[model samples]
Target chain A: MKTVLSIGVVLGAFYLLWMAAVPVMNIKWEVSQAQRAGVEVWLPESGIRAAGNWQLLSENLHLAAGTYAQEKPRLPSPVQVFAELWETTVEKKITSKRSLIFHAQVTLSATLLGFAMGTALGVVLAVGIVHLRVLDASVMPWAIASQTIPILAIAPMIIVVMNSVGITGLVPKAIISAYLSFFPVVVGMVKGLRSPDAMQMDLLRTYSASAGQVFWKLRLPAALPFLFPSLKVGIAAALVGAIVGELPTGAVAGLGARLLAGSYYGQTIQIWSALFGAAIVAACLVGLIGFAQTVVLRRMGMAR
Target chain B: MRANLNASKSASWAKDLNMIQPVIEANRLNLTFQTNDGPVHALKDVDLEIEKGDFVSFIGPSGCGKTTFLRVMADLEKPTSGTITVNGVSPEEARKSRAYGYVFQAAGLYPWRTIGGNIRLPLEIMGLSKSEQAERVARVLDLVELSGFEKKFPWQLSGGMQQRASIARALAFDADILLMDEPFGALDEIVRDRLNEQLLDLWARTGKTIGFVTHSIPEAVYLSTKIVVMSPRPGRITDIIESPLPKDRPLDIRDTPEFIAVAHRVREGLRAGHGDEV
Candidate 1:
């Protein structure tokens, strides 16, 4: 209940700030002389000529209401963005290209595919790194160094190279996502698999347990607490990687394409709505992983 | 079924043969650890023999090589010189044959597993069938007086209960030899006394050869048929005292004159060790 109340307080504060900032930030729509003739222009470009003009403006015009209700302003208020979101989602059919849900579906398919691929690749690499000395010594430094090169610079190169080989669609984006997501799993899992102390190792040795038994019974279960948190971070990174991959594809689909289209057509409202949609998707994905974490940890008797 | 009968017959024949041979024997064992401060002798010229069903306690101050000697017997550490054998074979071979069960200072129960699951760990690794594993787990939990706690996790139990569960884990495989490193050292005096009594009861019922390590004089004298007193600095045994206490004794035995006499000797041996260093 307290959490809900806190969230409400935060949203209300932001709304009030947005209302005050419209006039204070001087973000009124620029009126051509012809448009100015029909509508009363408060705070005209020429400075206020009289104290009576302030009264006239306050009585006849509401700059805050007008700024928020504009067809296009420098910054669209939260109301306009939400209204656009409602229209794109409910008023338009989901099959329509203009619908936000259609674009979200395009982006979500890639995100889910990329996330699964990334998680698999990460876990496999981690297991190899933990078990094989050669992989630990050789691959770990390279994994760290891979992250140093910016993802944006490499996204285009990966797409171009893959296109040359005729592997054009979702696979390319997923590879990029996998590349971004695998490092955390490797680092976290290496530490997790090694979490067993010398005494625990010695206990297993006394049992004369085989290597496979030791891994399945000890190292794997010990690594689980470490794995879940890394997965959460990896999924978020995978989503970002998927969206960035969309930017260079020049495709007229997905939230990335919506963002690009919004910029090209100067639709500030569209850009904001798309950004909110992507955020909502990321939150839901992370929340799903969190739900899984609780159930698994509880079954393991490790939950707090 | 006929082969099984013959197998038991041969096992009893092996036991008859083993009657004369000590279960664990050490000859001039020396282990020197190479550390940043140069070589530190963790054990030196340690010679001992533990007969079948004998409760032997190694009591010593810190760095006295008591724990180190136990580790060497468990094959956890390799001796730099000399030799030791378990069940007439090398430690490694005996370990592979599962000749002994070991308990450490900490309970070291995997928190993720229930008490029953932790006990079943060894059985599972040894590839026992599900029924046998369940049977053994139930048996050992009964042995440790934790019969009803099969499903409780380690954190759900108190410290004393957790230690008992760990003992049950060790006993699950029914090995003939039990090696314990100060298994009750962390408990309070009251709890420690209770565990000591319970442990002695367990030993009597099971007739297992037990090697225990501790620093407490009363703990050593009250529990052991033989007490091995050790000292620091080139870590070696200073004295070995044989206790004349009866096979069946109670907690009040610690107040006996015989018990006090043995504890006095142990304390003197410890002081003599420190005196030698000075």
Candidate 2:
């Protein structure tokens, strides 16, 4: 209850500040316009626009109200953004490409697919690195190095190469998501797989347990606590990758395409709504992983 | 030595005669660990023999090779140079045959598993029938007086009870030899004393060849039939005292004059090992 109240208070304060800033910035723009026309302007109140004369107070109020309702303000007020969100999401039909929900669904499918592939690749790589000294020496460095290249710089190339090979649609986007997500899982799993202390290892050795038995019975269970947190981070990164992926595909039908189309025509409210939509999707994905983590760790008695 | 070697190699007919052979024999055992600092001798020229059904305790200060020697018997560590035999075979061979169960200093129970599940781990790994595993788990839990608490997780139990569950886990596999490394070292003295009494009672009932490691003089003298005292800085056995106590002893036996005398001798041996450094 307290957390919800705190979040509400924060959002309320942010909206109030945004509402006040929009009107004040409009008056400041008016003052700048008057000064450019060689008409002296000054304000009695102390603020950034103190040089503006107070004679245009009624005109400034009308201009401020206009700024709040503008079709393309430099920064849309919170009410405008939310209204746009409601129209695009709740007001549109589910099947309509104009609906943010429809775009969100497209991005979500790619996110889930990429997250699954990334998790599998990460775990497999971690297991290989743990068991084989050769992989640890050779593959681990390359895995680390793979993350240093900018994904934006490489995303277009990946799409182009895949286009050349006629592998269009979702696969190339997922590969980028997997590329971003796998590194964290690999690093986390390696540490987790090695978390068992020397004494525990010695206990298993006394049983003369086979390597496969040791892995299944000990390392795998031990690594689970490490795997879930990495998965949460990976899912969020996958969402970001899916969105960025939509950009290079020439503004098709996802949230990334919405962002691209909004920016092309200076649709500020559209851009803000799309941004909030993407954020909501990322939050939902991360929250779902958190729910899974709690349930699993509780079942394992690893958490209270 | 030759007779013992032959007894190990000979067929089952030789075993029908009930041959006298050491269950664990170590001759000139040495282990040196190479660290960043230098080579530190963990065990040096350590020769020992443990007969069947004997309760042998290794006692010393920290860095003494008591735990090292037990680990060697478990094949958790290999001696730099030595000839040791467990159950008339190489340590590795005995280990592969699952010839012994080891209890660590900590309870080390898997928190995810209930007490019953933890005890079933070894039996499961050994590929026992489900009924057999259940039976053995029940039996050992009974042995440790933890029969009714099988469904409890390790964290739900007290420290002493958790350690007892670990002991039950070891006994579930029915190995003839048990190696314990200060299994009660973490508990308070009152709990430790009760556990010691319980352990002696269990040992008498089972008659398993047991090797125990400890740092306490009274603990070593109270529980062991043979106490090997060791010292640090090259870690060698300074003295081996054969206890004159009877086979069965109560908790009050520690108050006896003979128990005090044995403890005093152990303290002396430890002091001698330190060689005026203390």
Candidate 3:
């Protein structure tokens, strides 16, 4: 209920701002026309004049409606974006090219694939760094340095290179997502794997447990709390990577494609709806991961 | 030469009595930790022998290397110089054979695991059958008086109960020796006293050689058959006092003349070690 109230307030604020912008632009255009015609216009009691009468209230209302309902608006109103979302998702078939769900499905497939690849890679790298001194000394620094290279700059290079190697479409995009997602996992898992204190480690040593046994029984289980939070971050990064991956490719079948298409045609409503759609998808993914974390940790008796 | 002769004699004596061998023996043991601040002599020329079924306690102040000595016996630390054996084998070998169970100062139970799961951890690692693991877990939990807490997580239990669960974990595999480093040091006086009595009962029933480290004079006196008093600054043994108290000690026995006398001796030993440092 609180969330709903806050969202309502934010939407109302945006609507008021939108209503205000329309008249400001309209008056500026009208004043410029009057100056060009060499007519000395009197300042009306209210802001705007239309057809020589100070129809301020009616004209403002008309301008507001026009701004909100425009087929191609400079800044689409909330109702316009919401209507676009409703049309794309509810009016169209799921498999239709015009469907927001179709675009979302395309993006989600790559995000999930990338997330899985990233998680596996991160966990493997973490284990290597933890167990092997050479990897700790060599690979960890490189893993950290890899993240400093901005994904946006690297995504095109990766996509182009993979295209040259005859790997295009989903694989290139998924690879970008994987690249973005893995770093948090590596950092989180490494810290988690080493979370057991000196006494706990010594207790395991006293048992003469093998390294494998120790990993499975102590280190891995201990890393769970750390791992789940990282997975949430990783999945979000994966979605961002996937969307960004689509931007450079000019791909015509994802949310990123919809954004590009909307921008090219000046369809502000379509772009805004696509942005909201991506946010909702990312939120659902993270929420799903969080729910899984609670269940798993509870079963392990780590959660209250 | 004298140590060699004593070892041979004990071996023969052990055979004659059909008893378990000496649980731990250390001779001229020295452990120097090389830190950024230079070498800290954690232990120096420490000599000790612990036989099967003996309840031995190492009593000393902080930095006196009592815990270090216990760690050495558990193969958690390597001595810089000299030799230490656990159950007639090198510490590492003995550790590999699962000859001893070790309890740390804290309960050290994995918070993620249920009480039963924590107790069964070693059994699972040792690849015991599921039924056997459950049986041992149940038996050890019963021994530690935590029978119904099998499904409860470590955080749900009180501090003293958590410590008992840890002890139960150690006992699950039935190792012949138990090495504990200040396991009850964190508890309140009443809880510590109760645990001390329960521990003695556990010792009597199990017949395991126990090595305990503690800073408390009364605890050292009450729980141990032999108290090894130690001093810091090179970390050497000052005195070894064998308690004259009976094995079957109630909590009220802490007030007895014999217990008081032993406690007094331990206090003096600590004071004398301080005097030497000064």
- Candidate that would win on DockQ: 1
* TM-scores for the candidates: 0.94, 0.92, 0.90
Question: Which clashing pairs does model 2 show?
Answer: A41-A53, A42-A51, A42-A52, A42-A53, A43-A52
By the TM-score metric, which is better: model 1 or model 2? Answer: 1
- TM-score order, best first, reads 1, 2, 3
| Span of 10 residues, lowest total lDDT, candidate 3 chain B | B14-23
Residues B141-196 of candidate 2: C-alpha lDDT, one tens digit per residue: 99999989988888899999999999998888888899999999999999999899
**lDDT string, candidate 1, A1-304, tens digits:** 9999999999899999976655433233432321466765554445444334334335435444555666656678788899999999999999999999999888888788887887787778888888899998888889999999999999999999999999988888878888888877877788889999988999999999999988999999999999888888888888888888888988688888898888888898899899999998889888999999999999999997
The docking category that best describes candidate 3 is medium
Q: Could you tell me how far off, in angstroms, the CA of residue A8 lies in candidate 2 after the best superposition?
A: 2.7
Q: How well does candidate 2 reproduce the true complex, by DockQ?
A: 0.73
Worst 10 residues of 2 chain B by lDDT: B11-20
Q: For residues B145-183, what per-residue lDDT tens digits would candidate 1 score against the true structure?
A: 999999999999999999999899889999999999999
Alpha-carbon interface RMSD for all candidates, in angstroms: 0.6, 0.9, 0.9
**Model 1: runs farther than 4 Å from truth?**
A23-62, B1-13
How far residue B10's Cα lies from its native spot in candidate 2, in Å, is 11
**What are the fnat scores of the candidates, in the order listed?**
0.75, 0.75, 0.92
